[model samples]
Structure formats: structure tokens, C-alpha cells
Target: MATASHPHEHRTDGLVVTSWFAPGRINLIGEHTDYNDGFVLPFALAVGCTATVSQAAQDWSVRSAQEPEPVVVRRSGLAGADAVPEWTRYVLGALWLLTDRGIDVPPLEVTVDSDVPTGAGLSSSAALVCSVVRAVGDHLGLDLDDDAVFALTRDVENDAVGAPTGGMDQLVSLRGEAGHVLLCDMRSHDTRPVPLDLAGHGLSVLVADTRAPHKHSDGEYGARRRGCEEAARILGVPALRDVSGEGLADALGRLDDDELRRYVRHVVTEDERVLAVARLLDEGRLPDIGQALTASHRSMRDDFRITVPEVDTAVDALLSAGALGARMTGGGFGGCVIGLLPEGDVEAAGDAVRRAFADAGFGEPSLFTASAEAGARRV
Candidate 1:
């Protein structure tokens, strides 16, 4: 990931300040399995959100270069769900969530800025919330451990932003290492640190933003989430996580509805793919994991039906350009595609994708090379 300078960084120009960072994340193999209480393999990106806070004479206020009108929130109204300044609710809601967990919210002026691309499925929202939380924690002198950080940021996203994202984004954002992938079991909430050596294995991670608006607030994302839950209920299992190994066939046969079966199948199989990728990474066999990544894209496209035309086109172009493997990485519909390409071929791969998009009359995608980086912490 190419790092960009954000406004929140480096501010000693005649004002006292506190700055904290939260990095964006990319899932290498697993997709749409986290909400089903399954496995995910994700790594933090160098690109991330940063928050800068300084004392204000008035109540809590927030400003960002991305938006007009600084958001001001009164501490009294923070407890209400109908908080003011809707766009900045992520920050406001975080204050309330923290208070709910018995931490005191301090009044401060917060300016949140991010280099993480919005709506590209790189966990930008999570990064933003985590960055804000870190800034607030830093300002208030509240010691929020990693676990509290994960839960509070996730609650802000789900409750305040009304985004029905699973816990993977926040978990990875909180616990990421500079050179490791977090293998998190959503069902168990058990996390294992796995080493990542993409460049060492002659690979480069490419992220292509198709520039499609991707928001999980819509019914499309929630519908799939509910469908997966229903499928788990119908199968009489706690979740799809239980239907693995030799028992997978039995679980598939037990499902009566074809649509429900498809959802369950994707979860079960995708979870297995996460484990496969983790194992491959462990053995230093990065090239062999390409097939699993492609298979994940196919399952999301055919069975889960989340991949848009732009996503498919970009993935196809990357694969055709001799990428090791290509797939849509985020909550799918319209977002970005992550591909593992041979080192030194990213420019050609990017060219091929741009040309393919141009030929298809689609908007040009923003392509960037991604590298693993550290997670949220105060600067």
C-alpha cells in the first residue's frame, strides 16, 4: 500500500495535539464468511485513517477534509440514539459506546482524515472509527485494551453507522502486525498471528478499486446476511462453522431449499478456503494459494451473487495479465478486487485492467500495490 500524507499527521505548528492511526485491511482469501461465524485471513494495509485531536473551548466537534461543516456533539445528546450531525455519528457514537462500557468521554476537537479509499472494501469505515477511538482514548487518558477497542469500534459501525458488517474489520484493524495476517475465528473470537511474506515469495498485492459505490446499509448486503443466518437455522447447526470437515456433505444434503443451500455452501467452502490459505502461507507456498483465491471469487459470483460486472471484469483482466490469483476482496456488489501478481508485473497488470475497463465502457479503476502494516495506535 502506498502511504499518503493525511492532515491528521504531524501537527506541532503552535498547538498541543494528539494523533492516532488505524490502518485499512484486506482479506486474502476468506469472503462473506465472518458474519456466518467462520474463518477469515486478513492483513493490515499501510494505507489507513488518522485522527488529530486538540482541546476546543466548546463541546466536542469534528471536522474532516472529506466533508463540509464541522460536526458538533453535545455530551448530553450523546446518550440518545438520535444524535446530531449524522455524518459524524461514527465518532459521536464511539463516545457513547465507550461511556456505556464505563469509560469517561473527554471533550475535545477531533479532525479525522484518511488515505484509505472509501467504499473500496478495504475496511475504511473500520479504520476511521478505530482511528477516532484511538484519538479519543489518547486524549481522555483512557487505557483501552485491544479487545475493548475491537468491540467498541465495531459497535459504533453497527449501531451508529447502521452498517451490518461483521467483526472481521474491527478485529483485524485492532490486532494487526506489520508482517502478519490475522487468522480470526469469528465463532470463537480466537485469533492467531500468521506470518506474511508476499514480496519474499515473489508476489505483489494489487488492489483495484472499481469505483462503484459500496455501502452495506442497503438491503442487498443485509439480505445475504439474514439468508445465511436462516440457512444455519434450517440446517440445525449453530452456524456454518459447525458444518466443516467430513460433516460438510451431510450438512449440504440436509438443506432443502436450493437458494439456502447455495448460501450455506459458500460459507462452508469459503471457510475451508481460509484455512487452506493460512496453511499455504505457513508452508511458504504462496503461489499454490492462487487457485483458492480464484475459487473464492467464483463462489461469491455464482453462488453468493455479490460480484458486480466491474468486479468480474477487473478480476478477469488481472488473471489474464498473469496474476497469481484474483478475486473481489470486500463485501462485494461494487468495490475493489485484490490480486496476487508476480513482482514487477503490477504496472502491466494495471494497464491490462484499465484497457479492459475502457473496452467495456466502465470507469477507470484506481490501482495500488498493498503492503502489510501495523494496526491502530497513538503516534
Candidate 2:
């Protein structure tokens, strides 16, 4: 994990400032299955967003390093969500939700900076919300539990930001552990911190950010989610999670609409894959999970139709370079691909993908190694 810059206290108009850090999450296996009440295995990334906040005297203002102008809102001006700049909406959403839920959120000045690459499907927005929420909780001395924080942050994205995201990103960002992947049960909202000692096993996860822009609010994502809901309705189940792997073939046979059928197949099978990967992790069979990762990429590409060419190319190149298994990670369309391979081959595998992209005339990709890291914390 990259080290956070040391937090130094300074008096600005006699107000002390503090900082908090939250991590972007990488889903190890599950894709587009979180909202289906299925299973997801995500780990916190080393890179994330940091929020520095201080109690302001009156008006609330937020400034991001990525944005030129700071967003200022009057304490009473919380009704118009669209009044603020597009990026500051996340910050405003957090404040508005917390205050609406009876958390006495004081007007504050927040300056943000992040290493989490936006639009890379790394859950950068969730990291920002989690970080800012931590700052708010810390400043108010509120001892909110994980579930409360998760619900609030998740709502910040879903209702406040108008993104139809599942709660996986907020949950993982809040509960992720060092050297562990969070096994999130979307049905019961339960979590298990499964150990993933990759370095000890002479393995590493290579992340290739295709840098293809994707947004949760985009129509394609919403359509996939709607398709899942419609599939569940047609299947007579509360969620796709209830559709067991053993019953998958029977379920698919019932759906006449080819698109909805594909959605059901992916969610049902993806849930099964998540459990399969978790069992392998428990058994210390890290290498065996590689095939599952590659299979997941195929499911997203063929069944869910979320993979773009850049992601497909990265996965193909990684496998050709001898990666044990590889697949596109995140919400798909355009995002990063994760490969499980021997740690010694990280360089060669990255180089191979670089060459593949150059040959395909695609933009150069960002390659990095990510280990399981801790979740949101005060710095």
C-alpha cells in the first residue's frame, strides 16, 4: 500500500483540521452481481482518496485537487442537489444524507486529493464518500457501527448521486482488512474477511486499467440492473441469489427473452463462482482460482455484455503471457483487468499487455500490483 502523507495539524482561523483515508475496492470475482443479492469478493486497493476537513464557521465548502473551484453551500441550501458542481455532488450528498438522518453535521471546509483513478472502475467515488463520512463521524464524535456507515455511504451514491449502485463498494471500503478479501453476502448483508496471502504464495494480482470511461449512472449499467430485476420477477424469486446453481439450467430454460436469459445465467453462475473461489481460498489453493477468474471475464463478456475491446484485449494478453487466470474487474464496460500469476512474472505480463495495446492501436494502459489493504481510517 502507498503510504499516506503525514497529517499535520494547523490552525486556520483557530479551527483544527484532520484527515481520513478510504480505499478503492477491486472485486476479485463477482461482477454486476451485487445488486442481485448474490455474492461478491472484493479487496481494498492501496490507492484511494483522502479528505481533509475542518469545522467551518457557517457556509460549507468543498475543494478537490481535481477541480479548480471549490464548492460552497449554505447550511440551509441543501435542497437543490444539482446546484453544486458535478464532482462536488458526492461530497454534498454525504453531508445532506447524514444531516437528514439526524447526524448533526457541522458546516465544514473539506479539501480532497486522491490517487484512486476515476472512471477506472476502481470505486473511486465510494472511496471519496467513505473517506468524507469518516471525517464527519470523527469530527462529531459519533461512534457509528459498520452497518450504519455502510447504509449511509451506499445511500449517498444510490439516492444522492442518482447512481443505481449496489452496496458492495461501500461495504468493502468500510470493512476491508489488510491481506484479506471481503466475502460479501449481498442477500443477508453479511461479510467474512477471507485471507489472501498472495506474496506468501509467490503470487500477485496485476491490474491493467484500460482507462475506458464508465459511469454507474450511464444507461447501460441501469439497463443491466433493470434486466436483472425483470429476470427475477419472471423467475418468481426474490432475487437471482435464490436461483441456485443446480437450478440454473431450469431457470434459463424458462426465460424466453434471450437478453434476460443471459442476465439470469451470469448472475446465478457468478454467485456460484464466488462461493467456489472462497472455498479455494479457504483451502489455500490460490492457483486453482485462476481458472475461475478467467471464466468470470467470459461471463461478463459473453453473458452480461459489459466488456469492451480494451478490457478483452488486456485479458487475452495476460493469459497469453502465462497468467494463471485473468478477467476484467469492476462494473465493466471499461475498467481494469486483474490477473493472478506468479509474482516473478509481473514485469513480463505487463510488458506483453503493453505490446498488445500498441499493436491494437489502443491507448496505453496503467499497470500496477495491488495487495489487500485496510479500509477507511483516520490519518
Candidate 3:
């Protein structure tokens, strides 16, 4: 967890407001492996959300700069079944979780502002819930550690918000550090900070948002999760991650359904791919990890069957433009693609993706560079 400082406050209508920040995250590799108890490498983004919370005189009210209306609901109305705005549910869900846990949550007015692009598979929902949770904890002087925060935030999304997400987003958002990538082990719930000095290695990670928002409630994401669970049961393993690389062939042979076979293959191979990247980073061979990245993307495209045309096109364009490695990041179907390139080749890579999208009649992508950054904290 990042060190906390004295929260600066300003009065609005005689109520003091304090702000808390939490970052969105991008997985460098290992997509969809989180719930399967596999490995993942992700880093916190400098872009995140902030919640400015102040005690309310009446019912709890919440608003966001991105939304046109404010949500007003009483404590009794926050049963996770109220007709709250889709975005405001993240804030309300956090409050609901606290109250359900027997924590006396006072009514508060929360105003949210964020730069993290929503639905671009960047974990914006986690940032929203985490930032508000931090603000609430700080306001009440609660002594919750990182693990406690992770459980609260994750449960808020999964149970309260009905997102069915894994622990990767909330954990990485709370534990990420500057100049490092988090190596997350789902089974043990352990994380290690691996050094990632992109500039020092003369490389840059170019993130291009496909602008095709990937919604968690779309049923496609849930369907994939169910498929993995069924496959694990068929293989008699606790989860797909329990199937070793050496045992993968035999495990796949055991599954009669082709879809289950494909799902198991992707999870097991992706876990190995994550470990391979971690080793290269540990050995200070940053550039050598490119092959593993490209291979991970291919597995997602083929076995997982999650890549859309836009993401696939972006990856091909990035590779053709001299990127060391390029792959779609975040949950599949539609989201962002990250290209690892030499510093000088960054501009060309962006241009290549833009031209490819134009020629293919796809929407223009949003491009930016990302580096490791600090996690959630009061600001």
C-alpha cells in the first residue's frame, strides 16, 4: 500500500470533503487466468479515478463528472437491487458492502472524477470502488490493511455489483508500485514487484484503446468463466492452474468437448507464458520477453477465441511497424492492445495502427504510453 498523508480538505456548503485516489490497471500478460487460479503480470496506470467524499445532511448522494445526473438514495434503498445509474452503482456498492459487514456507514455525498476510460478493459470499475472505499475508511479512521481492502473492494464488485470478476484488478490496483510490474499468484494470493525500467531498456509500451467498450454484464465474459470451471471439474483438478505444463497434453486429451479442450489449453499455456515473462524480467532481459507476449496473444486469439477483429488488426499493424511484441490487453472481445517498441519506433507504431484501422474501416483508436505507478492512497 502507498503511504497515506494528512488528507487535505475544503468546505463545500459547510461540509468538509476529502479525496482518495486509486489507479486502473493493464495486464501485461495472462488474461482470463485470474479466476482459474493462474498467474498474471499487471501494472497500475498513472490514470485513475478520485472520489471526493463529504458527510451528507440527509440521504447519500453521488455524482460523477462523466455522468450527467446525480444519484440520491437512502441507506435502506442501497440493497444492490435499486434502480441506480449504472456508473453510480460502483460507489453505492462499496457503501452497501461496508454496511452489510456490520460497519456503521454514515451517509455521505461522493463526487467522482476520473481519467480512466470506462469499459476499455482497464479496470475503471475497480478504481471507482477502491477510491471510494479508501475515502470511507479514512473518513471513519478504520485500520484496514491492503488485504482487507482487497477483499472489501473485490466483494463489492462481485457480490454487490454483480460483476463476477476475479481478485487481480482490485489487488493490483491497491498494491502496484512505481518502476515495477506486479507478478500475481492467484492460488497463494501472493505478489512480487518485478523491475520494469522501460526507458532504461530503450523500450516503451504503447497502449491503443480500440474504443469498443467491453462490458462485464454482456454474458460473454460470464460464459467463458463457466466454461473454465466445467473444464477443471472434468479434469479432476481444483482449477485449470493445477494442470502442469507437462500434464497439459494429457489433460486436454481427457476432455471430450473441443471447447473445453481449447479453454484448458489457453489457461495452462498462458500461465506458463506469465512465468516465462517473469523469469526474463528477473534476469534483466526485458527485450527477450517479446516472443512470449506475442505467443500469449496468439493463444487468446485461437484457443480462448476472445479477440475481435479490431484488436487483431491492431496487433498485426503494431508488429508490422517494428514493435518488438504486440498483444491485446485486458479481458477479451473488445479493449486495448499494448505494443512493446523501441523508443524511436513508437510514433511509427501508432501511425501504422491508425492507418490499418482506417483502411479496415474500424474506429480510430486512442493511443497512450504507460509506466508503473503508485497504488491507492489518500491525496
Among all windows of ten consecutive residues in candidate 3, which has the lowest summed lDDT? 1-10
Where is the poorest 10-residue window by lDDT in model 1?
Answer: 1-10
Mind sharing the TM-score for model 2?
Answer: 0.95
Residues 149-231 of candidate 3 have per-residue lDDT tens digits of 88888888887778888889888888989989999998877999998989889999999999977988779889999999999
| TM-score, structure 1 vs. true | 0.93
Q: Highest TM-score among the candidates is held by which one?
A: 3
User: For model 1, how does the per-residue alpha-carbon lDDT over 35-92 read when each residue is reduced to its tens digit?
Assistant: 8889999999888888887767767788987887897766643466575766588777
lDDT-best of 1 and 2: 2
Full-model lDDT for every candidate? 0.84, 0.88, 0.88
Candidate 2 structure quality by residue, lDDT tens digits, 1-379: 0112324444556667778899999999999889999999999989899988887778888999988888788764347687777678788787887677676677788888888999999999999999988776666566778877888788888877899999999889988999999999987789999989898799999999998889889999999999999999999999999999899899999999999999999998999899999999999889899999999999999999999999999999999998999999999889899999899899999999999999999999999999999999888
RMSD (Å) per prediction: 4.4, 3.7, 2.5
Residue 353, model 3: lDDT of 94
